[model samples]
Target: MIDIDLHMHSTCSDGLLEPEDLVNAAGRAGLGVIALCDHDSIAGVARAMAAGRARGVEVLTGVELSVAWQNWRDVHLLGYGIDLASPELLRCLATFAERRANRNREIVAAVNRRLDHEGRQPLDPDDVTALAGGVMGRPHIARALMARAYVASMEEAFDRYLVPCDVPKTYWPMEEAIAAIRRAGGAAVLAHPTSISTDFTVLERLVGGLAAIGLDGVEVYNSMASEAEAAFLQGLTRRHRLVTTAGSDFHGIDPGDTMGKGRGGIRFSGALLPPLYARIAERQEPL
Candidate 1:
């Protein structure tokens, strides 16, 4: 059986751990397989895969595409088994990276101005780039704040400053993201649907639209989903004939904690892979 996690991040994105460190940590946590679903980037996949191989863990190529749905913002689309070299896929991701950098600059400037009002040294966007270059996310900014001791903790940084600019002004249209995943020969799963909206009526419509747009799966077991929410999403998964996916959404929150474990140290089992693999394989078949 595979002890697996379908989502995670590394220094290549918002996460603090380097790609190799994340994979190595997964191995230590007894994970047989894991996915590097970094936000809008596959830059870490190759290094993680190499580390996974060395550690006897199978690394699945994954990317978390950010999109918007309805009033909801920052909806994540997890693309599994993607072709990192897909030109179209790269083109779309490049746009996201550019926007993310701009957002980072804005967040840093805002936080610094606030710090100045508080009579303190301002932080530079370079501090975030020093952490991770390609994609500068809110978490990266939060870390920089923490580094300066501007905030006692990440939670404080977020609540006091970072939360104001969390969402990107622009995101890939949901349809375009799904289309990119398809073109990359991967399965697109809606990530943590309930995190943004818990109303079944809302999710029903959301899932329906996503299904119609070539989304292949629903993230039924996620760290943020309550038991009741998971059950609700599981019902949607069944209703839409979608594959169920799980992940820890790890961002180096606790170095001692395992990357694959969720809120209560719960990790996904390998039992999920057979069906998911089947679906990806079926999709790749000439239709």
Candidate 2:
């Protein structure tokens, strides 16, 4: 049975379920371990951990930071075993939230302007915030677009008005984020490398560069990763001497389905946990 999922989201960010409800669902899904790696937010982690304890699910301290490298779009870094009280993390997250809110407002204004030009009523930005509840995101905007029938699908919505440029550019440099994660007593793992691109040759160079700096692990098992992709990632892990990790990247939007099940029923073994724990411990050890 698939019991371990190290990545997911909750309403604390752009997810559809609240922290408690997400934990409950994970429990019902037979997930033994999970992490609430909400986008650039840790507000849900404490609640998730508490609920995890109640449901006998181990919730790790995880946060997925939005980062950008030179010409690379949306390079997310996942920090595991971070100290929840780290002031550095808290401060950065506050700025991220503000920037994200501003970005969402910009996109809404742009969309509304276009709608007004077409003689349609403008969409209230507040409606999008109501959907997100916390950190605003493109998914929230997409939902709002869908509700208004402005677009038939999420893809068309992005293609029409909510393009990436509409979003604010409040992001950390990849190196800076990795260092911050380390300072917070966490192991930094590159989240979903396969999502970067399909070109294995380019990915190899990217992984090498990241590893040369301080990347400790790669997400080898994820819904987006194919079997061949997973094997390629495993080879990268060995070559880079990095830890291996897996995650379903559950966002709680897909209701009625249990958590921890990655794309195409990909299952993770309990055996994968120790290496990550070991990496965390190693990071915590005094040099």
TM-score for each candidate, following the candidate numbering: 0.93, 0.90
Give the per-residue lDDT of model 2 (tens digit) for 109-153: 888888888898888888888888778887788888889898887
- Model 1, backbone clash pairs (residues 3+ apart or across chains), number: 1
> What are the Cα lDDT values of the candidates?
0.84, 0.85
Report per-prediction Cα RMSD to one decimal: 2.0, 2.4
Best by lDDT: 2
Clash number for each model: 1, 0
Candidate 2's TM-score reads: 0.90
Candidate 2 wrongly placed segments (more than 4 Å): 146-161, 254-258
Which residue runs of candidate 1 sit more than 4 Å off their true CA positions? 165-168, 254-258, 263-265
Score candidate 1 by lDDT: 0.84
